[model samples]
Target chain A: MPILEAKNLTYTYSIGSPFEKTAVDHIDLSIAEGEFVGVIGHTGSGKSTLMQMMNGLLQPTSGQILLDGCDIWDKKTDRRNIRFQVGLVFQYPEYQLFEETVYQDIAFGPKNMKLSEAEIDRRVRETAEAVGLTEEQLKKAPYALSGGQKRRAAIAGVMAMEPRVLILDEPTAGLDPKGRTKILTQLQAFHKRTGCTILLVSHSMEDVARYASKLLVLSQAKVVCYDTPTGVFAQSQSLESMGLALPQITRIFKQLAEKGISFEDEVYTVKYGAELLKTRLEGRNPEC
Target chain B: MLKDITLGQYFPMNSVVHRMDARYKIVITLIYLVMLFWGQQIWSLAAGLIFTATAVFCSKIPPKMIIKSIKPIVPILIFTGLINLLMLDGGDVYWKWWVIRITEEGVQTSVFMIVRICLLIAGTSLLTYTTSPIVLTDAIESLLSPMKKLKMPVHELAMMMTIALRFIPTLIEETSKIMAAQKARGADLESGSIVQRAQALVPILIPLFVSAFRRAEELALAMECRCYHGGEGRTRLRKLQSGLRDYIALAITLLMFAGVIVLNAVLH
Candidate 1:
């Protein structure tokens, strides 16, 4: 069964008014356990609106959100419990930090879950370790930390809840390349270590290509395509027509293929590209 | 539910009222209010109503929108009318029950008070509905430009109002986003005790306040980068012009007020 499922979800803003707009229109999505799904779209394509609906933060205009074979919006189901089970880290989450100490901020979710003191401490420490935060760093105020640290602390706050499903909206936005890679690597490691389902909403095709196994493309408030990253990237012409582009590596590889230099495997990451080049070079000059 | 708020809402249209000088509209509105209050006797009240109703028609604003604007203050209107009805004791009593007396004077005073308040609100709403906030503030600043010689800070006041009006919807949107973010973390904002709900707002308020400060700092930097130095040498793109329609509007307002005054004198 899927960890999270949205069936025919729709959201309309400013309904019954002259400025009314339909943001998300009848989107159907199903995310299975341990799957990292990447959502890509142009700005105002309703990606954030769909993310908010999955965890019950937004009630859909019509349709249902089912988690673990039960409707998340069921009257018998506790909406808050669904929230705890599905963690969401909004864009620029560092702006949401308000607690005096990093440790207290990270422990907020576990505390709200009514866990025991020792359990909360254990979860907080584990989350801090997962996000590469030092014990001393936890003692300081969140506002006093550097921007990257603040972001990690905010992500750790969601991780401490131990949710089975995690949704991140532009986790690497406004970050340096090193910082972006660090956060994405840490998220990938967390997914691998805990086997949790993850949904990442991003506009960067390269980031989505490297990190997500499945891909969903949105355009004009509708799902244009939903498939594996390779399948989605193969339709580069259609994506470009919609004012979008494929990952940088994918474009390079496609050019190489057009020039009659096909490789055995598709290379999406720098490491994979380097490996492919090394093998080709060894075949040309074995002594060197 | 916050979507229903139409305060300061600008409707874009190409009507005669929308094209008039906002400063003149403001002056005419003041004159209309003065005449409404100056009205006495049935003929004077009827004349005032006819003038207001005609402006309402020429403004091209939907009649229902004016009704919605008057909807919010209904409670206060009802309260004032009821108080007048219950308290006036000069005229002959029509009915008495349990120390509550209904008198002819009380009834007349209640109806007059209701009409006065209704006309007052309806007249102002027409101005707002027809004029955009930027135009309105610019008109106000222009009208008050003479006070700048008295060190009244008219430019700064108008600038502040413009900034506030621009940010109201942006901040409302930011607040809703913050509220959703907090709610996603198991923060129960709804279905809570009043105190609990107020407490739940802390999570939202902190982020909203932080973003507001961030926006202000960014705006300051942007203004400095653009060499902004207040309204010292600013020129308007659309200069306020007093055309034939403006003259006609003013004449009608004055003639209506004069006719009411004459009727009040003759009838009394």
Candidate 2:
């Protein structure tokens, strides 16, 4: 069974007003256990709204979300528990950090879960280490850290909860290239080690292509595609029409293929493209 | 859920009231409020009500929206009415209690106060519903331009007002976002005791303050980059011009207030 499922979820903003907007409309998808799902869309295509609904932060106007075969919106089902189960780290989550120390900030989620102080301390330190924060750094004020460290601390706050399904919205936004890579690589390591399901909402096609096992494309508040990264990138034309572009490497490979150069259509990452090119070069120049 | 707040929010629509100059609307609203409070007699109050109802109809704003604006102050309305009903000790008593008495004059005064307050809110809300905040600020600045001679910094004040009004929606959106982010971390804002709920606000308030400060800093930098020197000879794209409709609105407001004064003199 899917770890988390959204069935016909819809959210309308400013209903009954002139600004009424259907932010998320009839979105149906499921995140399997240990799957890293990438959510991509145009700026106003309801990616944030859908992510909020998945964790019960925003209630769906219609339809339901199911976690572990039970409706999360069921009256008897504690919604707060669902938040603990599905961790949502919003964009620029560092702004949400309020605790005096990074360690205390990271302990917030586990404390909310009513864990014992020792357990909370253990989780805080463990998640902080996983996110690459040193012990001295964790003891310092969160505001004293650099921007990237603050972001990692904020993400560690959610991770300390040990949520089964983690959802991060543009976790690397506004970060420098090195900071972005460091955060994403650490997240990749965390996912690999814990085997937790993750839904990463990102604008970078290349980043998603590299790490996300599955890609979900949204356009005009509806899901246009939900499939493996290779399968989704194969529909480059449709994705472009929806205001999304394929990964740069995939586009370059496509252009090469169109110029009478035979190559696989599913090359989405630079590493994979380089590997393909190296093999082709070795085949063409046997001496080299 | 915080989005339902429509107080001081402008609803854009094409209507005579909306097209009227903001200065005229503001003046007329002030005059209407004065009439509401000055009209003490039954006939004057009735005239005020009819005037407000007609203005509401002409504004073309939904009556439901006007009622929604009044909903937040329902408790105040009841409190005032109850105080007037029990405290006013004139005319024949209909019911008596330890410290509460319902007399004819008390009932009349309570009804009068409640109706006046309702009309006051309805009239003022119509002004906001018709005029956008930018236009309103422009009108205020233009109207207060004469105060510049007194070293009052009219332009600076108006600029500050406009900026503050503009950030209301932005701040509200930020607040909701911060609230959602906190809630996602299992910060229970809803089902807590009074103290716990207030304490829960710390998580939201700190982030809101941080982001607000960041936004202000960024805005200041952007403004400075664009050479935004505090309202010194800044020309507006849309100049406020008074038209025939503005005159008509002004005439109606003045005539209503004069008519209420006359009716009060004759009836009471």
Candidate 3:
């Protein structure tokens, strides 16, 4: 069974008001257990809005979201419980840091869960380590931390919840290349260790291509395509029409293909590209 | 769901009211308020209501927007009306119940009080709704310029007011963002006891205050970089000028006040 399924989800903002807008319109999607899903969309394409609905942060103006085959929006469903099960980290989450100390901020989720003090402490420490935050850093005030540290601290706060599925919206936004790599690598490691389903909403095709197995393309508040990363990248022209670009590796391969150099396989990652080049070179001049 | 707040919200329009000099508009609104309170009878309220309605119609602002602006004050208006109705005991008593009495004078006083409160809110909202906050601040600075002789920091006060008004919406948007972010991390704001609910606010308020201060510091630096120094020798991009339409508007307000006086005298 799918870990999460959203059937005909529709979310209209400012309903019954003059400012009424269909932010997320009739989106049908499902994420299987332990699947890394990449959601790509331009700004205002309702990717964020859709993520909010998945965890009951927002009620669908109309439709159903099922978690573990149970309707997440059932009248008796505890929305708060759903939040723990489906953790969501919004873009620029550092701005949401409130607790005086980074430790307290990371413990916020567990505290809300009403877990024992010892358990909260253990989770906080583990999560801190996962995000590469030191004990000294955890003791310091969140506001006193550097921007990248603050972002990591915020992510740790969510990770401390040990959610079944982690949904991050533009997790590496506004970070330096090093910061971005650290965050993405940490997330990748986290997924590998926990086997948790990850729903990453990102604008950068390269990042999504590197991390996610499947891609869901959103346009004008609807899901335009949901397929494997390679399958989605193959439709580069369609993605381009919506102001989206193919992953850098995919683009380079496409350029090579356009130059009449047909590789047997599509290259997505640097490793794949390197292997393909080595094979082609060996075929031409079998010296080594 | 948190985006419906309308406090200090300025609608963008290019009507006559939008184009009128903000300083002149402020002066005219003050004069109209004085006229509203000057009359001592029911006809004065009638006249005030009439003038207010006319201003609303001429401003080209939707009536629903004005109603929304006055919605917050509705509770106060009702409270005042109820207090006047229940407490006042004069003239002939029409009905008497257990420890309660309804008098003719009470009925009249309640209506008058409600009308006064409604008119006051409706008339003031006209000024705010039609005027952009920046223009309103400029007008306030100009109006308070006379007090500069007494060493009052009129420009500074105006500057503060403008910034406050400008940031009200921005802060509200920030607050909503923070709330949603915390909620994502399993911070349950709803479905809690009073104590739990209040405790839940910590996650929201702390971040909000942090961002607010950060914004304030950045704004200060930006202002300093732009050589902002207490409105000294500052030139305006738009100067206030009163034309024929303004004179006509002033005349109409005066005439309405005179009509109220005449009606009061005739009724007596």
Candidate 4:
């Protein structure tokens, strides 16, 4: 069964006003349990709106969101509980940190869950370590930490909730290349260890290519494609038509294939492309 | 939700009112306010209402936008109306209670007050609706230029007002973003006691304030980088020039105020 499901969901902002807009228009999708789903969309593609709906932070104008097959929008269901169950880490997460110390900040979500003090402490420390925050670092004020550390601390705050599904909206946005890679790799390792359903919302093809098991693409407030990375990347023309720039690595692979040196699989990341080239040079079925 | 604030939010439209010198608009709005408050009798309210309605019509802003401007002040309007209705003491007594009594004169005074207040708000908001904040600040700076002789920091004041006005929407957006982010982390802001709700706000307010200061610093750096030196040699692309339309508008408003005064005397 899908852990999080949105059915015919539509959200119209500023209704009955001059600024009325339909952010998410009749989006229907279900995310299965323990699946790392990559949600790709340009700005205004309704990906943010969709993620907010899954956690019930934003009530859909029409339709329902089911968490564990239970309607999250149902009056009987506690929306706050739904938020705890489906954690969302927004872009520039560092700005959301407010507690005196990193430890307190990370403990915020678990504390709000009304957990035992010991459990809150355990989750905070564990998630802090998972995000690579040292004990000394966690003791320091959140503002005292470096940019990447603050971002991780804020992400750890949400992860401490131990949500069944974690939705991060451009978590690595605005970071340097090294910081971005560090965060992504840490997230990848965290996902591996926790086995939680992760919805990584990003526009960067490289960010999700290596880790995300399934790719969900949206354009103009509607879903264009939802499939494996190979399947989604195959529609190069359609994706480009939607204004998503095909990463340079994808182009290189395409050029190679056009020259009749086709590989068995799509090469997304430079590392994966290198691995594929090595095997091909060693004479193991270069042409698919 | 914070976008509901319509104060200082300009409605962009091309009309005589919008095209008129913003300084004149500011002066006219002040004159209209004075007319509303100066009137001692109920007869003057009709004149003020008519003037405001005419201004609204000339501005060509949609009635919906005007109504939205009134929505935020409805609470204050109701509170003031209720206070006037009960507290005022005069004329023939219609109903009597222990501490609160309704009198014929009190009812008249309350109706007069409510109408006057609405027209007052409508008139002033019409100025903001027709004039963009940038133009409005430039007009103020031009009007206050003479004060520079007296060592008044007119440029600085106008620049400050412009910055404040410009950031209203930006700060509101930042606030909503912070609020949403905190809420997603299971920050319970709803269905709580007053104290609990206030406590919940800490998460949002801290981030909002931090980002606001950060933005201010960034803006300051950006301004300095572009050689922003306190308006000494500042040259504006658009200069405020009073045209025939402004004179005509002022004359019409002055005539309406005179008519109201004459009507007040005739009624008495």
Candidate 5:
């Protein structure tokens, strides 16, 4: 069974006003346990709205969100507990940091859960380490840290809750290449270590291709595609029509195929493209 | 959920009211407000009502939007009505109770106050619905330019108002984002006690304040980069010029106010 399921979920903004807009329209999808699902869309395509509904931050206008086979909006359910079970780290979450020390900031979530001090300490330290923040850096204020460090610290604030389903919206946005790689690598490691389901909302097709097991494409408040990375990227033409592009490596391989060069069109990442090219070259030059 | 606030919000539509000079609209609205308060008799109130209804009809703004602008002040309206209904003492008693009296004069005064207040709100809301905030600020600055000779800092005041008006939507959006972020971190803001709820706001408020300051600083720097040094001889992109329609609207407004004053004097 899926860990989280959104059934015919619809959310409208400013309903009954001139600016009324259907941000997410009847989006039906299920996220299984331990799956890294990447949500991609053009700006204003309702990716953020959909993510907010998954964890009960924003209520759906006309549908249900089921977590662990139970409706999250049910009257008997404790909505606050759902937030702990499903953590969401928003885009540029570093701006949400407010505690005097990064260590205290990370503990904010666990403390909100009313956990014991010792347990909060353990979770905070563990999450800080998981996000690659050193003990020295954890003692300083979040604003005192570098941009990448602040981002990691802010992410740790959510991770300390040890949520079963972690959702990150543009986790690596506004980061340098090295910072992006470091944050994504740490997130991947954290997911692996905890075996938690992650929904990564990203604009980079390459990042989604390299990390996400499944891809969900949103266009104009509707789900255009939701499938495995290879399966979704196969519909590159449709994605492009929606103002989204395929990964650069996949586009290069597609161009190569169009030029009569026989190569796999499914190559999405540079590493995979290099491997494919290396194999093809070895096949052509058998002497070397 | 925070998006429901429509205070000072403009509704864009092409109509005579929208096309009129902002200065004229401001002046006419002020005249209408003065008439609403100055008018004491039923004929004056009827005239005020007719003028407001005509303005609303011409603005082309939906009635629902105008009603929404009044929704927030319904409490004040009700309180004023109740006070007037119970407090006034010099007429034939209709109903009497311990510490409470409803007299003919009280009933008449209450009805008059309520109607005047409603007309006041409807007239002012029509002005906002027809005029955008930027244009309204421009009108205010132009009208107050004469005060600049007295060192009133008219340009600075208008600039501040314009910036504040511009940032209301931005700050609201930021506030909602911060609230969502904190809520996602298991911060319970709804079910907590009064103190707990107030405490929960810390996480959201600190972040909101930080971002607001950051945005203000960035805006200041951007303005400086563009060579903005206040409104000293600064020219405008869209000049405010009164046309024939504006004159006609002003004439109608003046005539309504004069008629109301005349009726009030004769009837009273």
Candidate 6:
């Protein structure tokens, strides 16, 4: 069964008022486990609203979300338990850090799960190591840490819960490029080590193209497409019309293909694009 | 759920009440509050009811929204009404139930008190619904300008109020975000004992306080960057000039107060 599935999901803000808005309208999705999925949309495309519904933070106005083929909104389900199973790191997760020490903050999720003290400690230390927080850093207050370190500490708080599926909404927002890459790489390593399903909501096409195995596109509160990164990149024309774009390297590759230099595969990442260009150049050198 | 509050929420409509100078609206509201409480007779209180109903109509705000503004204060209204109903000793008793006796005067006073409270709330809410906060701030500063000669920090106080009013929605949004984040981590905010629920609020309050301080610091730095130095020689984009509409509004408020006074004198 898919780890998370939304069946005709819908959310309307301020119903029956003049300012009523349908933030997420009739979205249906089935996401398999252990795959890093990227959700992309422009501002007000319902990305954040959908993420909140995934973990039972919000009850659907109509329809339902199924986690492990069980209706999450069912009366028999404990919504709090579903939260532990599917952790969500909101945008600006660092602002959610409030504990005096980084270690205590990282242990918050495990503590809430009613785990024993020793187990909570072990999970906190393990996730801290995974997120690249040192022992010295963990001993200090969260506010005392640098911006990147504080963010790492906050992410570790969710990681310590060992959730089967983790959803992060714009995790790398408001960070320098180096900080962004460090956080993403650590998240990648955590996924590899734990085999946890990750759904990353981001506006940056390049980051998602590089990290996500599957890409889900939302436009104007509706799903436009859900496909592999390469397949989605191939629909660049339609995506652009939706106020989204292909990654820079993929756009460059598309331009080259239009100029009669065809690539066998859709080029998305810079690494793969370099290899494709090198092979094409080497093959055409003798003819030139 | 917090966003449903219509109290102090401005409704943007191009009606005559909305176009009236905000200073005039403020004075009218103060007078409205005074008139709501000054009279003891039911007929005098009817004047306040008629005035509030008329103001609500002229503002073009929906009746449903006006009802929403009164929702939050219902508990207080009920408490006061009950105190008046059971506690007052009167000559004629209607019903008696073990220590709680409903007297004729009790019913009369309870109804009168409830109506007064409702009119008081509805009258002030109409002012907020019609006047935007920034304009309200400007009106307050202009009204308090006389205190500037006495070395009072009138400008600073008004600036503080403007900032506070501006940040209320932002802070509420931030609070809801923090609460949701904590809930996603299995923090059970609902269905706990009284103490446990209060404990759950710690996570929310700490983060809210931290973010509020950060925002304050950033605002201070930004204000400094723009060469902000107190309120001296500061001109406003929206000048509070009393126009023909304002004077007309003032006349209507004066007439309402006069009507209430005449009703009290004749009826009481």
| Every model's DockQ | 0.62, 0.76, 0.77, 0.78, 0.73, 0.75
Q: Please tell me which predicted candidate would have the highest TM-score against the true structure.
A: 1
DockQ for the candidate 5 complex? 0.73
C-alpha local distance difference test of each model: 0.87, 0.90, 0.88, 0.88, 0.91, 0.91
In the range B178-217, model 4's lDDT, one tens digit per residue, is 8899888878777689999899999999988898899999
- Per-residue C-alpha lDDT of model 5 across residues B9-119, encoded as one tens digit per residue: 789999999999999999998998898889888888898888887888888888888787789789998999999998898779999889888999999999999898888
Question: How good is the docking of model 1, as DockQ?
Answer: 0.62
Would candidate 6 be rated incorrect, acceptable, medium or high by CAPRI criteria?
medium
Interface RMSD of each: 1.1, 0.6, 0.9, 0.7, 0.7, 0.5
Model 1 residue pairs with clashes: none
List the RMSD of every prediction in angstroms: 2.4, 3.3, 3.2, 4.0, 3.3, 3.7
> Model 4, A158: alpha-carbon shift in Å?
0.9
Q: How does model 5 fare in lDDT? A: 0.91
Candidate 5 C-alpha lDDT tens digits along A1-288: 999998999999878887899999998988899999999999999999999998888889999999999999999998899999999999999999999999999998999899999999999889888888999998998889999999999999999999999999999999999999998989899989999999999999989999999999999999998899999988878889999999998888888988987674589889989988988887785776
Q: What does candidate 4's lDDT look like per residue over A1-288, in tens digits?
A: 989888898999999988999989898898889999999988999999988888888889998999999999787998888889899999888998999988999988998899999999899889988889998998999999999889889899999999989999999888899988888898889899999999999878988887799999999889898899889998999999999866678889999999999988888888889888887788756575
- Residue B135, model 1: lDDT of 84
TM-score result, candidate 2: 0.88
TM-score, every prediction: 0.93, 0.88, 0.90, 0.88, 0.89, 0.88
Question: After aligning candidate 5 to the native by TM-score, how far in Å is the CA of B264 from where it should be?
Answer: 6.9
Question: Measured by C-alpha RMSD in angstroms, how accurate is candidate 6?
Answer: 3.7
Candidate 6 per-residue lDDT, tens place, A1-288, comes to 788999999999888988999999999999999999999999999999999999999888998899999999999999999999999999999999989999999988999999999999899989999989999999899999999888888988998999999999999999999999999999999899999999999999999999999999999899998999988987888999998988999889888989998878888889998998888788785856
Q: After superposition, which runs of candidate 6 have C-alpha atoms over 4 Å from their true positions?
A: A282-288, B31-56, B61-122, B251-268
Which parts of model 2 have CA positions greater than 4 angstroms off? Answer: A12-21, A285-288, B35-47, B63-118, B252-268
Tens digit per residue, CA lDDT, model 2, A121-230: 89998998998999899889988999999999999999999999999999999999999999899999999999999999999999999999999999999999899998
Candidate 3 residue lDDT tens string, A1-288: 999999999999887888899999988898899999989999999999999988998889898999998999898988889999999998899998888799999999998899999999999999899899998999999988999999999999999999999999999999999999999999999999999999998988888888899999999998999999888877889999999988788888899999998887777788789888888887785655
Segments in model 3 whose C-alpha atoms lie over 4 Å from true places: A286-288, B9-15, B41-46, B62-114, B255-268
Tens-digit lDDT string for candidate 1 (A1-288): 777887888999878887889999998888889999999999999999888888888888998889988988899998899899999999988988877899998887887799999999999999999999999999999888899989999999998999999999999999999889999999999999999999999989889989999998999899999899878877889999888887777778878989998886766766788788788887896666
